[model samples]
Target: MLLCPYNILHKAERRKLLHAIGRCLFSSWDSPVYFSDVVLADIFTSFAQVVGDVWLSLCMLLPGHSILKPHTGVGSRWILPTVMSLPYLIRLRQCVIEYNHQGNTHRRPLYNALKYASAFPAIYLSAAQGMVVGEGGAAATWFGGSHIFRLWLLAGMVNSLYSFWWDVTNDWGLDLLRPRSEAKKSESLRSPPRRLVLPGLHSATPHILQGSSSIDVHDPEGISRSVVELSVRKRCHALGLRHSLHFPLLVYPFVIFLNLVLRLTWSMKLFSVVNVNSHAGIANFCLKMAELFRRWMWVFIRVEWEMIKKSRESHTKHRADDGIDEYELIPSATIERTPN
Candidate 1:
């Protein structure tokens, strides 16, 4: 928390900064929930990283204990995964709380919780691998046909794919699997999915703000259905166009590619084949740096997606106030609101 820039800001400034950060992390600016729950998860992860770094520093500073070697002992083998899993456990609990408290009509909250739950198997499997190698040594563990190695590989793959899918679909709002017609229907039928528009593209403000007859002050119901229809059409197309909204088009794809690569290999830190504490701890340093970069990209895209979603929701609400039945715009599901 000391490292976050929010510490230096005045109360008002801090509120603004926290709101933005909350959107990125939790997709909502519900202050109590964001500060108490979402921020707690992030803080736990930061502390875990700090603990790992401190451990590495100790390994380097006090070398007589053989702390720099692989299989340093039971404590060293288990500590990393234990610390790393703490944040996920916190997040998983939060998801369950939200699902129960708010009522899970769509089961979206449960699905989000499941994504966090997936991390545990990979994390523990890595620790198990380290423990096995400590007991049997690398030769027997790797070449002795140990099932742990293959099991760990399979667990890592499943965890990586699950996390990556959540990142792109739920977090980033890129429904890559749904067909184009499905995307169009989703956009038109329900309120537009919360999404960001590309930086260079036209603004995604509500039609009323753009000089469209979405609202006539004297007769708000006189809103042109055609105008609303056109707005929805543009928003549907903008979902794909906005992939590179904050950065250049090329930058987003590269970031996405890097995200996938990092996700797949994140468990490398736990692999017993190569000692992360060896080579002057270069492997540990590199992995930490890569993770930081991946998170930076994730935060950027996530905040943009949240901002767009908020905008679209506000627009929809304004229309509702003007006597427009937003649900009538499309033929399918009605927009439902979940309590914060």
Candidate 2:
């Protein structure tokens, strides 16, 4: 809701900026169906499953070799696929929850069955990919400076878990996914639920004996509909806050630091040169998985950001309407008139 200062820009340019930024900031807030919320559910989740399976296929090319490849048996062969399929598994669960409940009863079984079509492929492929990629030896064995290999591995694990939680909550509702203690701890941070009151409509017939407090009215249809919609909206607000992604207060920053430091220090050396050539297939599949996750995240983050913008805008508008001129709700494009 921060207004862009357009004093330097021409009127037309300012108008264009306002429109683009307004959209960038906020989209669907009151509506249950966010435009991009289901984008991953309908398409990308299944796509990732396919990519994972390809990796599995590549792993099959070299049988019985550990993820620690050149090292042979240091790490479990299944580690890579298990880590890789975390996102796919999370999405599959979300798909079941979101799509399975929609549409007619007869097609529900068909819809659920299709989730497996993607899920199984991704799981198998990831397992294969994990098994084939041999390790580059001990982190200290190769790079020697601080054993950064473990850092990258941990980062990957944490990021996947974080993303899984984000998808789960957004598809369902936040309150449904939140642990009870976490919910209680964060209770003071959320905005309070709005109260719904249709003022004069609720009590039209005053009871004189009850000091005009008790009353009844049953004549108007228009007022009744307003009451119903308002009730539903209020109930929604009370039910829960909107769900979206967030980094853990403490862990996210450290994860960022670790990624920057390790990637800078180890770079391509983290993966063995021989495996890079031998496991080109698995590498390609990993890229596909990364691409899939990046796209899914972009959708979730962008749309959720839009909602945040909208919510802020609504708040600012409310304040402005209440005569708080300190924060103007006026668009930047509106031209001010100067009398001659």
Candidate 3:
């Protein structure tokens, strides 16, 4: 068992070396071993589906753009897309099942299955041209009675997208989107920090590492932390026991999600957005501005919280002259005075 761990550490070290070489060659060295296969599969599955949907949506726009009248016997026009969506949906089901089978604690099986189920209708709508308003459009067949039903259908699609995003990101672990090597490369590119030793008499010296941001100093062994850390880390690195995870591209998806939510919220206002001719650009802009204002408020609150934390820590951590902690001091019932 010990040898097994030792061997695993060796492999991790090899990955580290490969990561360094990849940086020199400017390639994705830190990508998961199966990353290329995953990328290709996603291209076929996700990218192809997106391309097909955009094609159909654009085809509908042909009437508005005056390109040509859309095809009669719409069934023939949509047959391929509808057929294609079956495999996409099947793949999604299989993926969720397989993920559950893997015994992933971080991802819930039933929740993922439900999310996938939720996404199916939206996928079907996009693929089958269900949103088009005329001549057996999905909206007409399902909710032609009133505009309220139509808005409800649109809300369902939005909810599907929202649920789908949450499932995908959380299930797959956003770190899988980018290679660990890339994250390390960015980490390595930062300037070396300068340590400032603050004057203090204690078990550990209170100091700061001078850099772009102030960092807490936890070591006081009178040795370079990096060297000691590397040695200990090398010994502790167990290949199969410890897995590496990193995702630098998560921010992009979050930004996209924020915009999507903003757009959806904009659509919800005044029910005017659901009308055929009305536009929601003004609402979208206003919501985006409101989101920015909220973010600014959050930043201010965080800064104040940091200040409060520091004040508390400073007053709480002192050691008494009697080698007792400041908190250990108790109220004495009687007082004694020294006479000179």
Model 3 deviation from native, Cα RMSD in Å: 17.6
lDDT string, candidate 1, 1-340, tens digits? 4236554546665676666545445653232344234544643453445555556566656646555453366567666676667667767766766677543467877898887787777767766765665565656454443676687788878767887877776677665645677665665644543221111123333333332434433343444553464566455446553322555556656777898998676544533323343333676677767877787777777777777787677876776566322223323223344334
The number of the candidate with the highest TM-score is: 1
C-alpha TM-score for every candidate? 0.64, 0.32, 0.35
* Candidate 1 regions with alpha-carbon error over 4 angstroms: 1-32, 35-50, 55-76, 137-145, 179-182, 189-248, 270-280, 323-340
- Error at 122, model 2, angstroms: 22
All candidates: CA RMSD in angstroms?
9.5, 20.3, 17.6
Model 3 lDDT per residue over 1-340, tens place: 2224355757776665555434323333332223223222322333333344455456667654423333435564455345444434543544454454544455444554565454445444433333354344445464453553454567455654654354323422222233556433432332122133231333254433322232244454543554454454333222110111222323334544554564345324322222223334676457546545433433333344344445434533431122422211211111224334
Sort by TM-score, top down from the best: 1, 3, 2
lDDT of each: 0.58, 0.41, 0.39
User: Sort by lDDT, best first: what order?
Assistant: 1, 2, 3
Which lDDT value does model 3 have at 11? 72
- Backbone clashes for every candidate come to 1, 9, 1
Clashing pairs in 3: 30-181
What range of 10 consecutive residues in model 1 has the weakest lDDT sum? 193-202
Cα lDDT for residue 127, candidate 3: 32
